[model samples]
Target: MALTLALAVNELGTNSVKYGALSNDVGTVEITWSLRPGAEGRGRELVWTWVERGGPPVSPPSRRGFGRFLIERVLAADFEGTVKLEYASAGLVCALVAPAPEDRAS
Candidate 1:
């Protein structure tokens, strides 16, 4: 799970640097996450949001890239959750929902 998250983050960073918000001087990316109790008898669930702002006008991709595939498909399948990618005029936004690991014994 950690690896998956790391790879997802890396891809986002790379995309931002190459063509997204971080491509220019005035843009920014904000990433945040929260944990909530899972549904049914499951453990915790993680909700992560990635919001990019102040960049070039955003538009949905004509074709799906590998990075998008990883974030939207691979992670969703692996974590048994849902992923949403939004291309707003301001920037791109991604919301990832996944099952989180149980809290460790303390």
Candidate 2:
């Protein structure tokens, strides 16, 4: 899980450095995660979010890039999770929902 998360973060950070919040000195990225109940209050899941702020205005990419592909498709497949990428005018927002590891379960 640590390696998985590291890879995801690396990808995200690279993108940010190139075009997102990190492109500027004043911009920032916020990352947060929590354990939450799964469907019907069954197993637990992890809700991870990455929100960029104080950056130049955002706009959706014209086409999918490999980095985006890995983040959306590869990461989702790896964790059996869902990854959402939102290009808001304020910044980019990425939300990832996945089954929490067994050790993290209640």
lDDT of each: 0.85, 0.87
Off by over 4 Å in 2: 103-106
Tell me how far the alpha carbon of residue 21 in candidate 1 is from the true structure, in angstroms, after superposition: 1.0
**Candidate 1 overall Cα lDDT vs. reference?**
0.85
Mind giving the per-residue lDDT tens digits that candidate 1 earns over 48-75?
Answer: 9999998898888899889889999887
Candidate of highest TM-score: 2
Model 1 residue pairs with clashes: none
TM-score of every model? 0.85, 0.89
Residue-level lDDT tens digits of model 2 in 28-101: 99999999889776689889999999888999999998888988988887778899999999999999998887
- Residue 1, model 1: lDDT of 69
How displaced is residue 80 in candidate 2, in Å? 0.9
